[model samples]
Target chain A: MKTENFYISDFCTLRNGKVSKNGEQVYSNLESENIKDFAKGIYKFLELKYPKFHKMDELCKLGFLATEILFQDMEKIDENTALVLSNKASSLDTDRKHQDSINNREDFYPSPAVFVYTLPNIIMGEISIKNKLKSENAFFVSKRFDAEFMTKYSEILLETEKATNVICGWVDLDNDKYDVFLAFLSKKGEKELTKKELNNLYNQ
Target chain B: MAELKEELKEKIIEQLSLEDVEVSEIGDDDPLFGDGLGLDSIDALELIVLLEKDYGIKLKDPKEGKAIFESIKVMADYISKHRTK
Candidate 1:
């Protein structure tokens, strides 16, 4: 019988060349002025040398970078961590890249590297692999970022014991536009999560 | 034949996400799978696509990927004989 159940323990948001933790700026005014370059700068800032990062589509890179920054200071990462991430664009950004590869008959190349990231869940897989988390995970495509939905779903997973810990948020990107809001959730924390609180945090 | 092998090596690195690897590192006669290049099944599929998209060689069976993707030397020879465009 666990008391003081379900709290969104720590949260991180990355947008427009900045990373914030607990609604406070951690890294800001990134040297890169554009989104494409900003993503690379974040990867470099994190000092990640994983070759896979260069191969990933922009959406996966954004999510992967956010997760890396969120968990940078976190000491103990649980194995049963379930990732519940949602996005408005789904995998359209990479889908467009895949389409471009085959659209031109003269320059046709249905590249497997580009084709591999056609699914949104691939971002979760990338993060899971990097974090060494082999557990429950889900990816959703919505018209808009739904903070309430994320909180509710994460609570269910934690309450049902499907996952001991959860990393949930919005990792949406299309072209140069992007927004990432990731939160770490568990039953053993002080900040009890509510819909409004999640909304406030996500908006930050 | 030497030119073709060198071309295949460059294409393999470009097509696949072998970012850290350079064209000079991959040997023409070296094994493409397991120890030599460490290419897995997914890389094999990418090579299959490379054969069709660049050389117009369609491999309908999955088993065909093994013999064709053995080495850059083998791939160059196959492409030289079969390339349509």
Candidate 2:
């Protein structure tokens, strides 16, 4: 077995999931049943001040805020940091918003602000733009969060000399529900990042 | 003209998401674009939509927006004469 000597040095879990890092939960409202409200609660807890965050679609905001939490603690960042995020809806939340704007074309014109986020990758672009990290990025449309696929792909990025670190996760969002879990994978941890570890972290 | 300019300033702030700006700070002669208010091209399009939706004014050409959207006073003067809604 070729060991990549990687580890998920840092991570952030959002939405309704239960996980604790640094003695603080990223989002602690597991029983709220209102995902949108939970996302907002987490954003406020983080006290983010990016004005553009208000303009993003809910899905993009979820992903962006989660990535903000994940990147908050990191001191030094690699230039070739990569992102491999997936979502079951694949921008459907924003797509629906865009559709609503156009559906009422006779009454209201389609808004460019809402229409611009009609792609799933726009979330990644938002993160990339905020961080000024222009690394290799890919947004996957999956039936669900495939831990094995995320684990393997990020490992490949490390082995093939593509990225020094991989930010991988699932940012799934619908009308009032969202599940965003992001992890930073780097080969400089105490232990290697494995499928079992990713599965365990994701299921948390 | 005073009331029209005041209303136009409010509309510009609401339409352009200039949350940090207050109507009192915006002079009637201040440029709406560039470093004056720091509005961009997308804001110009939104202003066009604002005219059509609220005042029933449709600009035939995008270039016409530059002059019309020069300032709150100018926009108010245009809308006062052209407003259908």
Candidate 3:
């Protein structure tokens, strides 16, 4: 399989209850009670534009949205499309809250609420359900982020023809802060994706 | 009684993070659950805690809270009857 073309369809970010464009805050007043709500708010925003979104948890919302953006023009993205996601926190916010519940004498038991969000891959599950994608899915935790890892895994998916298109990004949610960046890589030789391109797109 | 209802409304707003809703928007008889303020099960739990902490009413079952917390008027009435504090 010869891997060649890929492009980004659409991307969104919510910071401090506001959508930022090129580092400028736009569309403020996002109502989110927690980190999950922040993720939900973004999902709700995109769901309006993309009708295919199936309501689910935050991580999946991120994945489904990324997949939607990747395959918006296509009729359907089959199980062959690989999903590669990276995050630093890896549901640490949920873990910390669950730990707090366990430590607290009044609520010493872990609520299923907190435990459900503990896994790093729940986002992928959300994406799979929404897009009906059963292709390869990977979740990695890094001290910062390894671009090489993303490129390498994406290459494997393409080379194997397991996926004609690859959806990859970094999504991290900690406390009140959340950030996400995703891109679609295809084998059609549309645009050459370089380290510089990824850095430039994400760094901003 | 009116004061308690107002306070309850404020507490509901604060607890639920209904940032967009104003006190004026919540009428005394307005439904707190479905279409009125659009609160969900989580908000109901928070309200239960509010009832216990503020009004000295402990509902042994969450199901019992459904009828008692139908609206601000209903909650205030239930609290008046059951409040130990």
Candidate 4:
């Protein structure tokens, strides 16, 4: 299979508890409570734009947002599609809190809630539940965001028929800031995917 | 007695990250794991630590904790009997 077409549906960046673009407030509706709230806010924004999806999870939210913006009637896309996600910090917030509990003698017992989020793949699990997808899932850490890896992996997924479609991108959440960019790629003859096309779709 | 249970609930809430759960929502006899508040194995471990830290009750085996931690009521009773503090 070759990529037929691809698109950039929706992207969100939350910084300092506010949503902004180029230092200008585009939307600001973040309540600083926990990571779940941040993840939910991103989900809600995308759900509003694409109402077809019934469940909302971090990874599914990213995939839906990208698909809605890029593909038309994304529900028509095959369900066996693969997902490739990359992040700089792999649940560091939860890891740090678990470490903090161990560091202090008084609070020597680590909270299990903090420990659950330590794995980087939890986001993938959330997405899978949301989309009802039982597809190949992978999570990788890069020193910095690597767009090339995403492009190459997506290509392999399509060419190998492991997936007719691939949803891939970078999602990183830190102390008070987060950034996400996702794209839905299909086989070339079935869709339009080129290096320049993908660069333009994501680089923005 | 009520004050201690209230404190325990607060500690449980903070430790578990039960963001949607409130202090008033937890019943005195509510099961702390499986069905009532929907806690699981990881939560059980956290409660074990809470017992050790707050009441100086060290459970040598995790299996021993299952019966003692059936619910907040059971947990409170066990702590009252075994607490060094």
Candidate 5:
């Protein structure tokens, strides 16, 4: 197996009503403990007016807002860039809502709006539409964030030239508890995409 | 008719999750889909569900929605005539 080093060009994390980039804080919402309000605060802080944003579920909002922060000061993401995201909950938050809409025999109201977000990969779709990225994308469901898998999968895309860049991270939300860590990877950057570095960034 | 229109506008906003749109902003003849309100096919389904859930009016033929959902006035007329609840 040929091993080649890749660099994390930029990264963003959204957790606990706070948003950070490259280990520095960009925005914080101490007042709003709810992920919905926190994500909305980030959107307002960024001054984004995308109307579709209001329609996304909680998990998609987290991933979408994190990506927005990740690319705020950077150039437009390459259309050839791939997206590789993993999350533990896998849209369970929205799934429960959708299920509840039909759980009652008397008040059954299965909303298409909520049902459309039952899958985890729909977040990738929202991000792709916003960034206009038409590259390879994958969503993995795991019990926890697997730094090694993310690193290796992203590296394979970079090495094979299948993508000029890769956006990799964990965007997990369940029961109002959420964590998002997005890293943009390419051939040139200040930090190498090693397992240790990825884990450290995730922990940071 | 005027009262029903007002009620329909409120229900549409709440049912469709039109968070940014105001009740007064939706004119009687404003298009519900495409450029008028920026609604999509999913929203179309949502409108169908709303018709059944709120007004007890099930849309037997989905194609009838285009004309009925064309505007608030049209939806009010349809619901007033067809609503069982």
Candidate 6:
């Protein structure tokens, strides 16, 4: 069954110490150049209460914050809302920290908390746990944001009844630089979920 | 004992990234897991590493963590009694 009509519903982007939803600037932190501080700023700005947010690595924090911004005004999405996120770095930021912990044999102290987030898919898990989303989830690693792939994959999930809705986009963080563009997709919205539209929103 | 309790609270906060929680907020008898201080199993693992890495106390039995890490006071007592370093 091919489901044709799906809208992009709403979208949010977090990059360069700022957050925007549907091309509108919602939050900005120009004072903090540090990525960790920027993430903490966004968490505080959203007034999020989940303590687990602090435990998340930089990649998960970026994705989690973007998802929170995307779902801020709307009611909770259903459990069938699938998550499809792609990134370039693939948890390299946390991987570096974990590597450093075990790099020296004599000074080794590998933390389980840091070890758990060594995979990029852990970001989706964090989002799912927060929103109670239990549908299909996939984390893809590519050279850059693949808007076309995201659109096609999300469409298949909606058409197959595997997901009533989807929260999909690019969430990549490497070094101190980060880029996130998360969109809420459903049968209702202002813009259609096309490759072109997704690319435009991602670049926007 | 009082000094050890304070140090344990500080170490737990630092090790576990309990950023929002302050050292003063945690009580001496507040349970470390499941609703008291809300520390989870991963934190329990961190406490184990903390015991070994910081205090030079190697736990022979994993079950000892249940009683040893019950609270700030309990952890302090256990560390004081068993710590090698």
Best by DockQ: 6
User: What tens-digit string does per-residue lDDT give for candidate 1 at A1-204?
Assistant: 333368888889988778888878877755776666787777877888887777788888889988888788889899899999998989988899899988988887787777889999999999988889988999998987787888888888888889999999999888778889998898766678777878888887
Question: Considering summed lDDT, which 10 consecutive residues are worst modelled in model 2 chain B?
Answer: B12-21
**lDDT of model 6 at residue A140?**
97
Q: What is each predicted model's overall lDDT from 0 to 1?
A: 0.85, 0.80, 0.68, 0.65, 0.91, 0.91
* lDDT (Cα, tens digit) per residue for candidate 3, span A90-192: 8886688768868967644444434666788888876776677778889999876566777777777777778877777787777656677777676554346
Q: Report the Cα lDDT for candidate 3.
A: 0.68
- Give residue A61's lDDT in candidate 4 (0 to 100): 40
Residue-wise C-alpha lDDT for candidate 6, range A118-190, written one tens digit per residue: 9999999999999888899999999988988999999999998899999999998889988899999999988
Better of 2 and 6 by lDDT: 6
Give one digit per residue, the lDDT tens place, for model 4 in A1-204: 543345333333444445533224554555648645654575465455332232232333433444344333454546686778887877775677678879988667776656666777777676565567778889889976677777777777767778767777777766644666666665443325556655554455
Stretches of candidate 1 off by over 4 Å are A1-4, A24-36, A104-108
lDDT of 2 by residue, B1-85 (tens): 8988988889878766665689999999899888688787777888888889888999999899999988887888999999999
Candidate 4 residues lying further than 4 Å off, grouped into runs, are A1-27, A30-79, A104-107, A187-191
Badly placed stretches (over 4 Å) of model 5 are: none
Using Cα atoms with residue i matched to residue i, what is each candidate's TM-score against the true structure?
A: 0.87, 0.85, 0.60, 0.74, 0.97, 0.97
Please give, for residues A1-204, the per-residue lDDT of candidate 2 as tens digits. 555478987777764444345236745766656655565666677787665665567888788887778777778666688999998999888788778877875787766666778899998888888888878899999898898999888988888888889999899887776777888888776546888888777776
DockQ of 1: 0.57
Error of 1 at A65 (Å): 1.8
Steric clash pairs (candidate 2): A6-A187
